[model samples]
Target: MGESTAPILRVNQLNKQFGTGCRQCNEVGSRQLDKNYCTACGTVHACQQISFDLYPGEVLGIVGESGSGKSTLMRCLYFDQEVTNGEAFLTPYKDGSSNLFEESSQQQRYIRNHLMGKVYQNPVMGLRMDFSSIGNIAEKMIAAGNRHVAAMESRGSELLEKVHIPLHRMKEAPKNFSGGMQQRVQIAKAMSNNPPILLLDEVTTGLDLSVQANVLDLIKHLQRELNISIVLVSHDLGVIRMLADRTMVMLDGQIVEQGLTDQILEDPQHAYTQQLVHSML
Candidate 1:
């Protein structure tokens, strides 16, 4: 992605916190908290002034340890968790003039169905285990107002095949599939709407090493073939290295470093990021 290319998605000053803010924690620039939490107020700032731009046909990786707010950030973007405050603009929605966070729930639903797709870390969160793999894909299509059964079936089958899910088992529920296979089904379902943006939160976590590679490879292939923009969140730097063109390092609910993947790997500036890079070596 070039600097001149307008961002497909832009997020500004995003914040998500739990618990009511006390005066000590609400002092803004003067507040001092332990990491991202306030002992005095018992408020956990999951994400703080998080901002970034995702360009078209690019993969922007967010890497951080657990509790560093990477997953929280993803959840906020997907509207799984309501943000305390933020503004996100999507070029495809309202000409990028409206803040998505301020949109009505109905409009957000439309955006989720037509403009973006998300594959959660846990398959249970993304898929209805009781529904057939094809049926899961059909559910998303239905949300997008797709009414043609024949078209949905054809699209579902095509997507499942693209993700390497066998057509023979398309009618089987995800509960019967292996962890990796279930993840693949989730990916297929997320892509069912042919959305421009895909949000993947730890999609390969908990799988065997071999399975991880397969799922990652499938994602890379799909991104190239479809030219879709992706915001990929993972704790594993290796995964980020393999797929992300640009990378952001988050620590304590803030972005500590961000740049091209190669530069960050070769010469990390932040102590936390350096530690993360060294551990991957």
Candidate 2:
């Protein structure tokens, strides 16, 4: 069969509930939980599956209110945390297989180092705060086995310029930069290795509108130029509409709605999704 229309980043019956002990063989009482929800009262579900077909050069937005499991799902897919059950496949167009859900830690490490890139919620989450902005990004490139890694001395200058940072400030600590600039640095770092997939979690949360627009535009520009698949974790509808080709709406740890951006925006199917759409306007 050819590729299914679903998505390259496929989640098959994926479920995650934060609790103690193994997925199977754990006693319910010892595992702390009033319900399926986390102790924080995040929602829980009997069957929470997250799947989408992320063809090269498309962005998928995962949006929902706080405690809606957007971050949980992203972290699960990113391999920062384990899924309760099911699989997440990260298939590349020209690659042999996705295997993001592979059992081998070595295989996971291989993909984490080269096949995937991440932008976490906090600006510094994916960056080395102690390092200069450019060095932060360059270190990732070098670690990815760029034996003769081009002197980031020049490339870093160019990237800072591309992201609208002063080229001369490439050597400045990322901490010296404001929140917005820190976010930009994180973006720069995420793009350094040029992974086929990017997991962006609330990338513009604290940015001003102008900076947010700039960052969003930079992402759009890079997506086109790099032809990378992006999974955006955000609460902003405007950002989602502008950046996503499709959207996944989660509620109570379950996907209430999912489909093409226009479909979900114009005619949301679920009650929760409808509320999200109406609230955006």
- Candidate maximizing lDDT: 1
Estimate, for each residue in 54-160, the C-alpha lDDT of model 1 and write its tens digit.
99999999999999999999989988889999899999998999999999999999999999999999999999999999999999999999999999999999999
Model 2 poorest ten-residue lDDT run: 20-29
lDDT of 2 at 258: 87
**Candidate 2 wrongly placed segments (more than 4 Å):** 1-7, 20-47, 93-98
Candidate 1 Cα outliers beyond 4 Å, as residue runs: none
lDDT of 2 by residue, 1-281 (tens): 13654455666777676544343324433544433454444434323565556666779998888878888887877788777777666655234354456557766666776878888888756888889888887887787766554666666777778788887788899888888888888877877766888999999988889989988999999888878889998888899999999898887666778899889999999998888889888
Q: Show pairs that collide, candidate 1.
A: none
Ten-residue stretch with the least lDDT total in model 1:
23-32
- List TM-scores for all candidates, in order: 0.99, 0.85
